[model samples]
Target: MDSIEPRNIPLTPGVYLFKDAGGHIIYVGKAKVLRKRLASYFRPDKTLTPKTRAMVRMAVSVDTLSTTSEKEALLLEASLIKKHRPRYNIVLRDDKQYILFKLTKRHEWPRLTLTRKVVRDGSAYFGPYTSAQAARDTWKAIQRVFLLRRCSDTAFRNRVRPCLYHHMGQCLGPCCLPVDNARYRAMVGKVELLLNGRSSELLELLQQQMLDASEALEFEKAAELRDQIAAIRRTVEKQAAVLGSERDMDVLGVAETSKGLALGVLFVRGGVLLDGRNFFWSGLGLEEAPEMVLSFLGQYYGPQSVVPQRIVIPWALEEQAQDGSALPVMSDSLGLSDEEVLADSDDPLAALAEALSELRGSTVRIGPPRGDAENRLVTMAQTNAAEEARTSASANVEEILAAKLGMASLPHRIEAVDVSHTGGRDTRVGVVVFEDGKPAKDQYRTYAFTDEESGGDDYGVLAAWMRRRLESGPPWPDLLLVDGGRGQLGAVMSVLEEAGCGQLFAVAAIAKARSEDSNRADRRKGGVADSIFLPGRMNPVSMRAGSPELLYLQLIRDAVHDYSLRRHRKARAGSALAGELQRIEGIGPSLAKVLWEHFSSIRDMADASEAELAALPGIGPAKARRIRSGLAAMRTKA
Candidate 1:
C-alpha cells in the first residue's frame, strides 16, 4: 500500500516499522496505543527532529507486530533493532568515547593509566570522564594526595635508585627502596575507594588515623594524613555532592537533538557524585519518547550488568494511577493481578526496575527521584545531558559547529575545496569561499586536474590544489575545509606544514559515510551523515544533521562539487572534440572545423565517399582516408 492511515494500525501494544520506497525499514518504534503514537508522525503541524522529519518524508508504508503486552512489545522492539540495526534506532553499543581509569589489579605493582575501553579482565576500571582533560585532572589529584609509585612495570624493575619522582615526593620510591608490599597494597585500596566515589569512607578512615597519629605524637604522619584528607574533601566539593546516602545509585538523564540523542549517567556512591559519563548517539528517531527511554535503559543495564541500588531517571512514571494506562498493556504471561498492577503501577519506573532488583540481590528503586538531594542529583545528570544536546542542537550553527569540530576559532571567513571525479576520471578541483556564512561566489575558482591518473586519487588532487595555493600564498581564510575525510585532511595539513603555515590556520575534512552494503536500507543517499574529520583525533567530530554549521559546510562542499563537475564535463567534451581532429594526418583543428561546418554532422561526414572528401579544399585523398579510418575506429570503439 502506498499509504498507511493511523486508524488502520492495531491500537494494542506492538512495534511499528516505517519503510521507505524500497520497502526498507528506516525507523522502528513501539507504543502502548499503536494508532495514537504513530498518528503523531503524520500530523503536519507536530514538530519532529530533523532526522525524524527526513525519515517521515521518505516513508512510503508502515508495518506492525501486535504484542499481547507492552513489555512484550518492548522486548520484540529491542530484538528487531539489534537484528536489523536500523539506521534510525539509536541503540547504544558504539557510543563509548569517554576516558576511563584502568588499574591492573593482576599486576604485582599496578599503576593507574588512562583508557577508553573497559574489558572483562579481572583488573579494576573506573570512570568514563567525558574528556581526556577531566581524566588527567583526576590523575593529577591522585598523584598529589596518594604519593604512590608511578612507573611502568619495566621501569619499576630496572630502576637502580630513587627516581626524580621519589626525590620530588610524588612517589613512595617503591623502586630500589625497602617498601612494605602490604602498606603499598593498602594505599592502592584507598586509591580504588577514592576513584569509585567512596571517598567519604576513605576520608573518615583518614581522619581517624590522623587523630591516632596526633595522639601518638607522630607529627609528620599526622600532617601527611591531614593533607590527604583535604585533597579528598576538595575533590568532593568540586564534584557537587547534593545527596548524602551511602547506597550506590546511577542517576540518568537524556535529551534529544537534531545532531543526536545524549544520555548522561552520573555514578553516585557513598553519597557523593563521583563521575558522570555522557554517551552520544546519532539518529534522533520518532519512537515514542518514553518507550524509547525505557529501551535505552534496558539495553544499558543488561542482565550481566552490575545494578546499583537505585537507577534514578528524570521521567514521570505513568503507572502511578490505579487505572494507569501501562497496566492493561502488560501481558498476562507475567501473571500480574489487579493488586500487583497497582502495587508496581508506580512502576512508571518501568518493568526493568524489577529485573534490576533481582539482579542486584536487593530492592532497586527506579523512578523520578524524590527529595531535594536525590532530585538535585538527577538534575545534575539532566544538566549534563541537556548541555551535550545543545552542542548538537544549538541554533548558533557556525559557532557551535566550530566548537563541536574542535576548530581553533569561529570560521567567519572559510574556504572549502572539493574534488570531482566522473566515471573515476577527468577530475577537476574547486575552491568555494564563504564570508560570514554566505557563499562568496566571486571568490570561487575551479581547476582541471589533468594528471591522467591523479584524477582518481582525491587525496592527490586535493594535495596538488592545496600545495599550489600554499606556494602562491593567497590570502588565507580563518578555516579551510576539504571535501574528503582524514586522508585528504592529512595531505592538506602536510602541505601547509611544509609551507610553514600549518599552525597558522585551522583545517577540517568532511566525508559522507558511504555504505558498502548495496541494500536499499543501507543505501543512505540524502540521509547519510557527512562526517567531519579533524587532526589528532581517531574519530570524526560530529555535528548535528541540520545544524547551521553542517548546512554551511555542505553548502560550500556542494558549491565546489558543482563547480568541479562543470569544469570536468567541459574538459571531457573538449578532449573528445580534439581527439577527432588530432587523429587525422594532415587535417589540423582549423581544417576539421571547416570540414565539420560543411558536413554539419558526423553522420554526414561518414556518408560522404572518399572522392567527395578529396574534393573538399583542405581534404586530399591521404587525409580523407585517415579521417575515414578514424571515424571507423571511433564507431568501432562505441
Candidate 2:
C-alpha cells in the first residue's frame, strides 16, 4: 500500500483520513501541506514510533478533504473526530462542552439557567464550563448578585405578580412590569466581566459606589452594596494567589514517562489562572515529549477560546513563530535574552531528531526549571498530567465494552429503537440517538406504522420502520440498539438487506428480562433484567440492570417507547374520532374535523340551516342537509 503511489495529492489545507484493510478509519489528521506531509510517510524513513508504524501498516488507503485554512482544517478535524472517532486518533472521552448555561430570554424577564444540554436555537448561552457544579455555582452567584429571575419563559410571561424569588431578593421583578433595558444590559455586562476574570475592576467600581452612597447618607443602599462587595471578595479570595503582573498568559507544562505523555495547559486570565486541563496521549515516549506537546498545544490552544496574550512554555518547537508576547523557553543558561531563547528553542530539526530518539523509550534530559514559581508551575502540570493519565488508564465503561466485545472503537454514539402499539389501532416506531454516553434528544426520530396493522404485527412493524429509517437521510450509526431479541434482530436484517445497507452499520438487540423462578410481572420487583443480543449471536450478553451502560440503554429504549406510546395515543384518539363521525354516512375525518372546528358544539350544528351549512367551505347543500337532518333526528329520538 505504501508503495502504491503518492501522486496527484492536493497541497491545500485539509483533514486526511487513513483507513485499514477492513475499511475502518484508523487515523485522522489535519495538515497545512497535505501532499508534503503525506509524502513523508511513504518516504524511506526507517525510524517511526511503534504507534505510527502500526498505523502505517494498517493504512491501505488515504482520503483527504480540502479546507480553506489551517483553522478550518482544525475545526474539520475536530468534527470528523467527533463523527467517526478514528482508532489511532486522540479521543476526548469526556464531553467537556456539555456544561452550558441556557438563559430563557424569551420570557418577559431573562432568567439565569445552568444546563448540560444546548440546542442551537436563538436562546442565549453562557458556557462550555468544565464542571456542572461550577456552572451552577456561577448561576447562583449571578442570581444573588444580579437579581435575575429563574422561571421558565412560559411561567414568567404569564405571572400576575413576582414570585418567592422576588420576595427573597433574588430577582428583580420584570414579569409584571418593565425594567430599563440599559440597566439590565449593565448588569449583564457586569456578570460577563465577573465570569471573564475582571472581578477586581468590578470590585473597585462597587467600592466606589458604596463610598458614594455612604457619603450621601443612603445607609440602606450602602449596606446592600457592601454586602455585594463582600460576596464578590469572598468568591475571588477562595481561589486567590499572587500572580506577578503577567496578566494574560498560558503556561504549558508537560509530564513524560516511558508508557505515554500527559500535557497540562493552564490558562491565566487577568493575572489569575482561570482553569487548567490535562490531556493524555498514550504510547508516546519521553524524547518525543517536546514535539508532541508542541503539536498538541498548536492544535488545542489554537482554538479562539483559549488563545492568551502570552504563551509560557517549558520548551518550544518548530512551528511556533516569534511574537513579543511569547515567553522564553525555560533552560539551564542564566544569561540569555527572551527572544534569543525563543528563536533557538523553535528549531524543527531538533523536534524531528527528538521524535526519532523517542521511539526507543529512552529519556532525554532537558534543562531544569528555574525558581520556585517556575518549578511550581511545572510540578502542577506534572501532577495533573499524571493524575489525568491514571484516570484515563483506569476502568472506563466504554473501554471495557470495546475490549470485551472486540468492537472497532469505544461505543460512544449508541442508537436505540423501539415499537409501540395498541391492539391493531395505533402503531409507531421510535429512534433515539445517544452521544458521548448520553441522550442527544434532537436527533430522536419517530415512524408511524403505515405499512402494517396497529398491533400483533411486531416483526412486520419492525421491518417496515427499519426500511423507512434506511431510506431516511440520517448518518449511519456506530451501533444500532433494538428493544427486542432475535426476532427483532431478524426483522431488521431483512430491512437492511432490502435497503442495501447491510455493511453500513452495526446492530445489537436488548431483550426484556424473563423469569426463571418467577413470572414476568413478579420479575419486575427488582426491575426487569435485560440481555443484549448482537447480530448473528445465539446467546445474549447479560448485564446488571442498574449498571451505567445497561441503564443508559434502557433509558434510550424507554424514551423511544414513551415517544411511540404518545404518538399511538394521539393516533388512536384521532381514529376513534374519525370512526364516530363516519357513522354519519357522508362525513370522514376531513369533513368532521371541519364541522367540529367551525361549530364546536353539536347544538350549534343542529341549529344551522341548510343555507348556513352550505355556506361552509367543505359542506355542500347535500352534506349540509344531511348534517342538519342527522342532528335533528338524533335530538328528536333522545
Candidate 3:
C-alpha cells in the first residue's frame, strides 16, 4: 500500500473512496474541493488522528465520483456509504426503517395502519416514529378515541357481520353496517388533527360536540365524547411543551464521553416534544464531531425519511471566517481561477440546508440555537445524550466478556448459530447477530439443508452451515457461538480449517446442563446452568450462572434456538403444502411454487376463487378450475 498522490486528483465537488490493497473500499467521503481534501490526508505537516493515519496507511488507491454540485456530492456520499458500508465511515448499524402512520384517503371507509415505507399512494402519513411500540401505542390510543374503521379494505369488503370491536362499542361497524358517512368523515378529520399535534383545537371541537349532544338529550353520545376528550387530554399531557409557537423542528445535541460520541435528536412538533432518539459510536472523539454530525444527518434523514422544517444543532457544522476575513483563494491547489474558487466555495451549512429543504419539499432552517427557549431545548437534548453515553459506558459488557472468555480482543460483534429439525426433515440453521451488545435483527439469517445433508445429524448441519457462512464472507463475526458441545464445535472448526481460514473468527459452543439423577440434559430446570466450550477445550468456561456475560450468551443462544425452530416449522409447512399440490394432476413443483407464492396459507388457497387462480402467471382457466376443485376436495377431506 502506498499514499495516493493528491496532485493528480481533480478539483471538483464529488465523493472519494479510499481502497485498500484488496481493492475493498475502507472509507468514503465527500468534499467540495476534492484536491484540497485529498491534500490534507497526504500533507506531511498535518498530524492525523490514529484512525485516519491507519486508514491512510491501508489505502493503496483512491476512486472519485464527480457530482455537479456540492449538494449532489452530499447525497452521493450517503448512498455510497449505505451501499458499501466502508470500515472507516460512521455507519449507522440500526437499519430498521422508521415507522409511519398511514391513513387511507381514497377509500370511502378509510382505515389507519402502521407502515415502514411511504409511497405516493394518495394516503396521508403522520410520523417516522423511531420505536415501533410507541407508534403502536399512539395508534391504539387513536383507535380508542375515534370510531373509524379498523379493518383493511379487503376485510371490510368481505365481512359478513360486525366484528368483536363493534360489539365492544369500539367501532361504528362501517364495514357491515350503515354508519353515517358525515359522522365518520368528521371523526377522521379529528384524528388527523390529533396526529398533526393540534390536540388543543381538537379538544375544543370535542367539547363543543359533547355540549350539543347534551342539549339534544343524547346522553350516551355525550358520555362517549367526554371519554374521547379525556383520552385525548391524557395523551397530550404526556408530551412536554418546549416552544411558545406551533413550530415543528428537530434539535440535535452531541456529547463526547469516555465510551464514545453520542448524538441525540429531539422531535418537536407543534411546540411539544413528541419523541427523541440517541445514536452512539464507540471510540469517536470530539475532534470528529463535525464530520460525525454531517454524516449522521445524511444517513439518518434518508430519501424516504421524514425531514423537519427546522434543525437546531449545538454548534455550526463548519467554522465560519471571523471578522469578515475571507478564506485564501485556492486557485493553485484547486486548479481553478480565483473567481471560480470564490463562487464555488459555498458555506457547507447553507448547502446542507438547501439539500434538506429540497427533500422536505419546503424551506428548512439549520443553525445553532438562538433564543433562551431554544437554548433550553438544546440543553435538554444534550443532557439526554450525556445520560445515554454514561449508561453505555457503565455497562462495559464487551470488556467483561473479553476478560472472562480469554479472547484476543473485545468481541464487538457476535453471531450465534442453532440447527433445528424434526426427524431429519425440514432442517434449518438459524444465525442470530448481536452488535454492540444489542440484537441486530436485520442481520439475522437462516439456511436450509436437504434431508440427505442433515440426516438428523446436528454435527453435519453445523458443518454445512459453516461452509455457507464462509462463502458469504466478510463483516464476519467476532465470535461464532454454536448450540452444542465439543462435537458441534469440532464440526465448525474442521470446516473452517479445511477451507484454510481457521483463524478467521473465534468459535465456541454452548451445551445444556445434565441432570445428576437421570444424566439427561436439564433444559433450565432446578437452577442448572448451561456450559460454554471453546475449541479444543474439554471443560466449560467458568462463568457464574447469572453473570451479565453468561446471560448475554444465553440470550443469543435462546434467540437462535427459537428462530431455528420457527424456520423449521415454516419449512415443514411449506413442504407439506407443496407435496399436497403435487399430488394433484397436471401440477408440478413449478406450479406448486407459484401457488405457494400467491397464497399465504392453505386456507387462503382454499378461499381463492377460480378466476383469482386463473389470474396467476401460468395457471390457465382449466388449471385454475382444477386447482380450485382440488383445494375444495382437500378441504372437504379435512
With candidate 3 superimposed using the best TM-score fit, by how many Å does residue 402's alpha carbon deviate from the native? 3.6
- Model 2 clashing-pair count: 1
In model 2, which runs have C-alpha deviations exceeding 4 angstroms? Answer: 2-5, 21-25, 67-72, 93-128, 148-168, 174-193, 245-268, 275-382, 388-396, 408-413, 421-456, 460-478, 493-506, 516-529, 542-638
* CA lDDT scores, all candidates in order: 0.69, 0.64, 0.80
Residue 8, candidate 1: alpha-carbon lDDT: 60
Residue 245: error of model 2 in Å?
Answer: 4.6
Residue pairs in steric clash, candidate 1?
259-544, 317-348, 319-345, 344-347
RMSD for each model, in Å, please? Answer: 22.7, 12.2, 4.2
In candidate 2, what are the lDDT values of residues 324-371, reduced to their tens digit?
343322212233344433442334434323332342234322233445
Among all windows of ten consecutive residues in candidate 1, which has the lowest summed lDDT? Answer: 320-329
TM-score for candidate 3, please give it. 0.86
Per-residue C-alpha lDDT of model 1 across residues 1-638, encoded as one tens digit per residue: 34765346666778899887756676787666566456545423234445566777878888999888766676677667754545456554333235667888887666788776656566676755656787788898888888777776655765688889898889888888888888888888999988777777899999999999999999999999999999888866676555665667888877776655677888876566667766555444423455456767766664335557787777674631233233333324334444443442234355466656665667988877778887777777768976866764333665676688666545556788877776557777888877555566667787666657574787777778887887554345668888777888988887778777776568888776566575222223333477888877888777778766677777777777677778777667655765676676666877776775576556556656677778888788987888777766666675
| TM per prediction | 0.49, 0.65, 0.86
Candidate closest to the true structure, highest TM-score:
3
User: What stretches of model 1 exceed 4 Å from their correct place?
Assistant: 1-17, 29-94, 153-163, 173-176, 253-266, 275-288, 298-307, 316-365, 370-372, 379-393, 398-456, 459-638
Best by lDDT: 3
